[model samples]
Target: MPASLGLLRALVLLLLLLAFLDPKWPREGRVVYLLDFSPSAREGVFALAERLPREGIFLAFAERVERLPAPTARRLDLGERTDIQRAFLEALKLSPDRVVLVSDGLFPPLAPPFPLDALYVPPKPHVALSLLPPPYPLYGETVGVGVVLEAPRPAEARLRVEGPGGVWTRTLRVEGRKVLPYAFPLEGEAEVWAVAEGPWGRSEARLRLAPADRARALVLGDPALARYLEAQGFQVEEGPFRLPLEADLVAVGLGVLDLPEGAPEALRAYLHRGGGLLFTATPRGLFFGGWDRVLPEDLPLKPLGREGAALVLVLDVSGSMEGEKLSLAVAAALELIGTATPEDRVGVVVFASGHRVLFPPRPMTLQAKKEAQSLLLSLRAGGGTVLGGALREAVDLLKGVPGGRKGILVLTDGQVADDREALLALAAGAGAEVSAIALGQDADAPLLEALARRGGGRFYRAATPKELPRLFLREGQEVFRGGALEGRFPVEKAPHPLTEPFAFPPLEVLLPARAEPWAEVLLRSGERALLALGERGEGRVAALATDLSRSWRDFAGAAPFLGGLARYLAGAGRALALYAYPEGEGVRVVVLGRLEAPRLLAGGKETPLLPAGPGRFEGVARGEGVLLDGKRRIPLSLPLPGEWTPRDGEATLRAMAEATGGRLLSPEEAGRGVRRPLPLRPYLLLAALLLFLLERFLEARVPRGTLREGAPG
Candidate 1:
């Protein structure tokens, strides 16, 4: 209450409030040297880091972060997976006056706290190679092989390709931080090698290809069907019903009734162990033969067969189809007959000046297909092109048939010089799907395309004999699907490992069957699965109801479908790859897929391929042979590691520095060091307490009434 007491309290309050300021004295400066230790950084980065002034503290980072007590020149072994933001946060924790990052700029872009600067270390001079995608592509037609080349400066690169077509090379100049990319389109087996050799250093990379593949198919009990399988690009081998066969696919034409002979059971055993089999019907109706006891009922089959269509083939044996054209046409027809179901009624008509029915429309049994083939082979070519008479005969063959599924296929090499309008009229009156194929350069293509368009069928043309058979089979699909194509049921693709790179070919004839509970249905048409894959014991089995007898006529995705199916059956499902890229002074090899302790082999030596992640293996290759896993051989070569490809991250580092109100510095600019602000709050609090005690002592010494209110400084 006294004046001295009030003044002392005011002074205490003032001292306490000042403690909250906690101010500090400003000094010179201090810096934290943030260094990149990734493999991508220049080889001299470590030595350069050590040469910086002692005024700055050192911090190093790559895929990981660490604070260094002293500068050192060596690898941190912290992989190329850069985390700049994380590294920046760690540098801020050191509480320096400023932080300077010394790096090749390979680290990802980052936004740092207020006190971060960059001492950009340009990337080491080197040329490296890598594939565009980490994985290799499937082989079929022309497939593009992608290449990536990274260089610090303009590099002279040479690319070489060796394959079924032999070897060729090309040279070019590549530059800058952006990768120089190139793609080469190839078909069949191919191996490629690339080299970038110049003043910067010599770097190399190569691509290796698998051997050419052709599936071996076995045909049991029917040589007639053996020829049919060969047309599908398979290597066919006829059999006397033997076991332990060297075949990827097998077709059984015998009735299941002979199961007691052990042949059917043996085939079933083969299927169980991973062999592919088609329990196809012969000329005679397919007889299950009471073999349900030995064969699994889950096998997708159509014992009753499909209701078939009526197809008429009107062939032109005109003078134009005299030599190779006529011979190929006959061969094409022979393959065509095998596509029809036994229930389908098929007829063959030949025309030149006049027309004659070679084979009348009847059930297409095994005997019928053979008989048609024989009849077609014996036919001779002569006279002018006369299509009207052939159309009349074909119409007559389909007269009794319903309009729903009747078909007329007209083949010709010469233009219709006689009765063209009459033939068109006859074809229209038949109320059937009429498809046509015009052969050779002289054939009338417009008329054929128009006929097919009007009749709701696909038109085909074969400028060469090579295209004849495929066109024939594609027409079979229209006839098999019924007159106007009532939209055949769409095939449903199910998720499965076999469905990798999934696609469906245009299916012509699919046997209706049910899948068992354990069976894996990969493809389906309506409720019945068209293709089913399963593993029973030591082998794999596939039930493909879609008739492969139907040839392809440039149907999109069909070739891949067939190729993939054959490869899958032939033990190609395991995805294992070995790839090599430069890593620092060595070559880093990567293997994808499961394996135990895999290794990289080069120049007859082996190096351990260590586990890097789940399903991924990595290691360093010793030399350039690039062979590993006893199978794959990658031609890996590079003068420097691939991690140095993008050159440097100068732009990214500069942006981060500018964002934080910092300047890009050099390794020599390490003088920015000064201790952080010193706290004064503790001293101020102590002073306030001492003042309070002094005020209390004075009040006690002066008696209570003597403490009077007065203005005092």
Candidate 2:
């Protein structure tokens, strides 16, 4: 009876201990934390992550979307852009039952593939500076500037402009997000600033202004093209591609490749010295193909043929190419033949299970053109595609052709049983290039590209039959002007400074489309953005949506716009030299020129700047600003905060929280309500002591001699 009582006491003690010490398994759902690693979102992300439970939480950097190591610091320095959508999609693949996201909500929100919780950091107050008109005004010209303020409530903003004359200040009332335009004559270099006092406190933005300079342009093409540059205040100099020492820009015309031996190297050196080059050539110009090494490494430009070529049109007439593909292919070939000059021989080869020479190599005489057109119209699609045989026939036809360059333009709608490597080797051996046109989305793109690369020719793709003609025209004729763009698209006001005076007649873009993260959309067509501008390294790039061809119909009045864009891109070579950016709580100055020590002049006092890095200096400025680099004065400005369009992300955060079945709270509220790690050591120790006391008490009460201690038989 005594032993039974002891056992009951022990059982009660174990139950109490179990209740006090709660245990969890590793397999339990983890709270995966996906945080933006962008510059402005880093601090807030880390702060929120630190306050959350550590055991069940996992850390993933949203920039690259990978788990941070155990020794990851509380916060890290972030500079590059973040792809939030890609990061979220990756996080969902981990199949975490719960997720937490933190960001400043500056970037666009993409639909989540899966549900998750989000905590948004409040946006910091700031102002934006925008140049409104006269995007490329002459020196000492007056231009209109727009100032935008983003604040929580009504506020008074102080505006100032400091230039060759002196400092000018004005006061204006603003609420929420407001834009106030101001006109200022830019005399040499200038600086503009706006300071606003709002509910979130004081916010400021500074902008450096420099009127466009009259460029000294060197022209290598027909002097007629020089008229365009001359209209843009350029002192045109006619010469070969042998870049002159005084030339600020070089414009090479089509078929101009005879450089004075080391000229390309000299041009490379010139680019490093802040000189710019513009090549105007057909998409197949030799400049784009062989001279790419002279251009910037990150330049998103395609290669072109380096010399005039005797082009053989190799066409696929397989059964698969019957419908629209065959029709487009025939039309594209005719267009290419029309573009060939009398000096360039044009030939045609059609293939199905076998190859047939539709037209032998010959100059495009009037009679020859008619004959080619009639032959193309009569052709019909049938049988299987043997690409290798067609390529071999085309290469053989170009072997004896009298031309400095030789290549074949192959148009195919589908893959075929052919030895691709053998075809490439044959083309190479015959000293011929092979360009490929992949029609329709199902066309073998990688295969075509490989053929082009191996044969040392350009590759083109037609997403639909409608694009086949344009693609052919782009590649066949001298259309791609050495990556130069010319279009008359009417520009509605855009966010980028490059498109400040964006106003053009309604027109369509004809070039291939490209999208880079760093690029800013400057113009749009309905919902499709047409003109995109960006800066890479130290050079500026402008990508247009349409092909800028004489066939664009609306390009008659676009000369001014095209010239302005060219000058803008050329001047961008110097834009990076005098740039100022916001760093932490101050403005950092980056100059390309040589200087011993740099100091910032603000509000009549000098603030010494320490060397931040190579060719960079850092200092704080409250109002209008200027920089003295011992040799000369450089205007300075802080980056406008609205550059990313930061906003209060409460709505998005709430939506995400509800989607994932999680609660929404501010940082302060989260800190107060979030579960803290429970310490079980004390509770466990207390339970043990209580159990021991109970055991002693029970033993004493059991009467030592009266208790029977025999074992059960």
Candidate 3:
């Protein structure tokens, strides 16, 4: 029985050997050519198809793939939907070893059913920046054609201008992920090219430029300001009486005289005809009333009364200020006070460790003026500087003063130790402009500048005590009064409803030159929607109080939404990261397409992975701990345990998802839809089969060898 079993096993082995040795002419390697025939797919597909090897499978799909030419292996009809998964699965049926997917790399939102090795041939003749007519006219004018060169690190790119004449070359410096703008004068139909040559590769673009008709502007101001305007080549009119209707620029310096009653009507008509008016006030308060009506707010242009000017001087003295520094500050203060009118009420506050009122609100009397001088003479710098306390006290003293125009001039050499925001809030609410003069090298210029901006004032950096007076006097002329608030949207907790009410008092924003205009209503619930408000108008801007997370909430915590409702709003062409997710246990992460980053961020930390590939990343997570990006304090929690809901306080979660045009799905859905683990079962089965063959061979050959050796002995 054992011999018979051995014979049967030998027969089975012989049969397997015969099967392996028999040559039935092995089939040639099959190539499956996937041709995408979407409506937009043009000659690129046909060009790629011609490039493929002659004897291979050709599959075309617009509505379906059919009618194969000779030497083509097979044909398939994938109805309507260009489902890659369905086509891949059908290719698997044909058992093709190689696949060449020739299509515009635009994939429909569908999870691949099976793994497919695809060589994608994307469509060429790519348009980088969409060429559209400039929103503002640029016809027949030497308007600057800014060519933005975007690259990874600082790189050198050649900028070429091809117009009516020919191509002109210029060099450009490109910072990492930045668009370095190079200006070119547009004559006629022109193509601007920015070509970068580096280790990575090359990129180029050709933009069309046309002529623009130059618009005329009439500038009106005092001789000093008119000179500045004339320097900019504006037709300036220095006015005695209001200029004639033809003047495009009207600059009036009402040096203490009431503007003629007809001035407002004429100014209104001038503005209606696209004319500009720049009015500067004089010592007398004549321009205060009528200008207030024409301007958006009255306090923005008011004069710095005696009290406000006096506070500016005292703020210059403190413990940190001693010797020549203190004297210089006093001299600057005296110079500022000398400009004030007797009717102007002045108050003085001295701050060091605490606050003291040197002179309470009083009419600019001879005695008070003498006292102010005496106070300056008697001032001594000894204690630690507490600017916040001094600012609070100064604001308190100026609140009761009866004057439409008011300002606070602050002088400090150091940053405030405490309650800086509180002091800023008080100064803003006091309805008085707060300007600052930084003395010496130790002054916190940035902090002082922020303080000045919050209080609707200007900031000045004075190198020495000698410079303080001049800086203060020059900036004191332009006082920005009234409260304004600024803050960024919460990005950590997003997608969840945000319905909390936040308030920001009205503010006057000095629009930067040629700023790309955009407004966003960012809700606390992590929802931000862009709004279109027409170019340049001034009025009171308010944000309504509503719960953004509520069902019916429209303008909840959204300033832009509220601003849009009234059409009385006063207010980035940059591609930013939108979403990211982890793929499998192999430490790989995937980011949504269209976002370019210098490095990938995960779990609050940045990873050094080049984002130049097709938005997919495969690398070790670097560290043992989880990575995080953006605000770290906001933890991602799964609310309603066992259910995949975002924990409260994740302000940016919703924004991150929405910004990338993605949905904040459940963890289960994300795991199933976005991430797929590598399959180990096939490799394991192959290993098992290999081991079984070895075991069977060893059993058959070992016994036979041993038996043959023993018999010979």
Candidate 4:
């Protein structure tokens, strides 16, 4: 049989098969209209309905999906939420051959079951800032709250963060999708409000600020620490030293055992009655003073074991540092050397017209101490002072040694030739700390003070050799007591009443001391205790090996740490909190602490917050007002609803139609019913038949050639 004849027979057989399948042409049939009744889509739905084909079936959906009898002027209230997917899925159940969706396209894109067409309504461009849920904060703390801001373009927005401390207003530039953190100062009462407004949009969130109660404390000897405690929400009264009978805490500064006439008695009574007493550590208090007498015998603190310390002493033997000044400097050096145990390594750097290392860091053994004293006694004052050079040499010597608690103590009676302040600042990052002592009146007090502070060590000033104490020396020249935790170190908090998720400030004073067996260590530096607590009879007692300067007067971060500590001492726990924020079209209220009865008052309506679980409760409310729980009233503002969340919905509509083999329709096309997808089987059958006939004609007309088994044609 010829190939063309065979192809013709095959085409005839395929044509019969195509006819049997019975493919239909494009035509509108059994059409269904899925209408969006959501608030964002309502305007587009009603307007489109007037122009939509009345012959088609109609279904309306928002919170509920249902068939509509007809397009009418009356609007049905099916709640505010828009559910486009639900409406489309229901339309398929009706066996519609074609589905047309009318909406603003504000809902998530949906892939319809049948060929779908869409009439889109676009929403206006909007900007909004939604605050994340806030946490129940402690008194005197800054709550860092996150807010998400969305805008089509950059917006200059004004934000107001209000607390019991007062309202703080901030102006910032905002753009598309940025998460910003705002710190709200929580004061005596926990009620905070954050409001952001701009030309684009305005959003405000209110927190149920129910901060813990303020702690009452009696502070003696240290008003700086007292003031810092106040910033952290402590009611502090500076004193006559007589512990108030109702006081929750008492702090004695400088490790002074010399209590006012009735103080010791009052303190003992206070501790016995379950009050808290904080005692500082000092050499005078431990050796010369009455630390043992003040604290309970059972709560006695032990001195730190012999731990190695890296000591570098810089001395100036200039013409100005002659008789008494030189002697005093040597005496101070000797005292510092005495404090070091056999395990400690000590180095001495002396400068005259030049600087030289008298001795490198070596173990302070019996012979080493003797050799150091002999070298110091033989030193003579001469030439100009090279104080800066001496310090450099000392730091270099310290670097050679390894370990924590490394220090450089400088004894200078004259200013350096270079910028004295810059010279001291240079020592800030050399791995070791730099402390300075001014042996005479001419010494730069400010320069040395700066050096000591930056080095995380001590600065002392002496007018004459007489100012040097006999037994003990402390920072700032006034001495006698050696603090147990007596330097700058990062404090570690243990789980206790005195701790929270608090950002603790840098503490400058801590004595190397251990807590008593009866004491529960609340704070630590390395393995040593920084703050410890014990109880006796009805009273409580605390031992602070640090200088106990929770003073915010200089350090900004001191407030929260000390405030939380003072609050715990005053017998305050985490207080009840009521949180309310805008979610969707309504407000969500959450209760933090266990409350017998919690209620929200908003939009002139009162609603009770139901308990969800242990220490957790929640409910929903509409509009704005205040949340009330017992005597507490926290302001509330519910912002954007979910249906009103920013979205143009145009892309969603186009995508949905394209996904289901449909098209986005204009008002004119929607009125005539949606266009159906053209059938492909008819085109396939016609192309196949025509190609077969063409193939036969080409074969009959064109020249044909045949090749033998091995011959080329």
Looking at candidate 3, the ten consecutive residues that score lowest on lDDT are 637-646
lDDT of each: 0.64, 0.60, 0.45, 0.65
The residue-by-residue lDDT of candidate 4 on 1-713, one tens digit each, is: 24555567677678757756767577667888878887656765776677776687888889898778776545787777887768867887898878888887765555677888888865433455566534434555455556566553456888777655466787887654555666655664455577788775677777554554455677766666687777666778876565355555776663333454445566676666456666655343442244542343534455567346677777888889788877777776776565455657888889988988888988878799899988878888888877777887787787778666677777777776657666757678757767777767788788888888887777777777665533123421222123344346887888764465654555676566777788788778788787777666555566666554431236555556666555555432234345555554465877665355778787678999888976578989776666677776655544434565555467778888899878898878887754465676777678767866776676576455421322344
Candidate 2 vs 3: which has more TM-score: 2
Which residue ranges in model 2 land beyond 4 Å of their true spot?
1-213, 222-225, 243-246, 254-256, 272-274, 282-299, 303-537, 541-560, 575-713
- Per-residue alpha-carbon lDDT of model 1 for 191-246, expressed as tens digits? 66655566666767676654344567776554544654454456778766566665
lDDT of 3 by residue, 169-215 (tens): 76655552232334443434666554544443455656555443322
Instruction: Give residue 370's lDDT in candidate 2 (0 to 100).
Output: 91
Best-to-worst ranking by TM-score: 4, 1, 2, 3
Candidate 3 is scored at a TM of 0.26
Q: Which regions of candidate 1 are displaced past 4 Å?
A: 1-10, 16-23, 28-30, 43-51, 60-97, 110-114, 132-145, 152-154, 159-168, 176-195, 205-642, 645-648, 658-663, 666-713
| Model 3 spans with C-alpha error above 4 angstroms | 1-316, 479-713
lDDT of 1: 0.64
By summed lDDT, which 10 consecutive residues of candidate 1 come out lowest?
284-293
Top lDDT hit: 4
In angstroms, give how far residue 55 of model 4 lies from its true place.
2.1
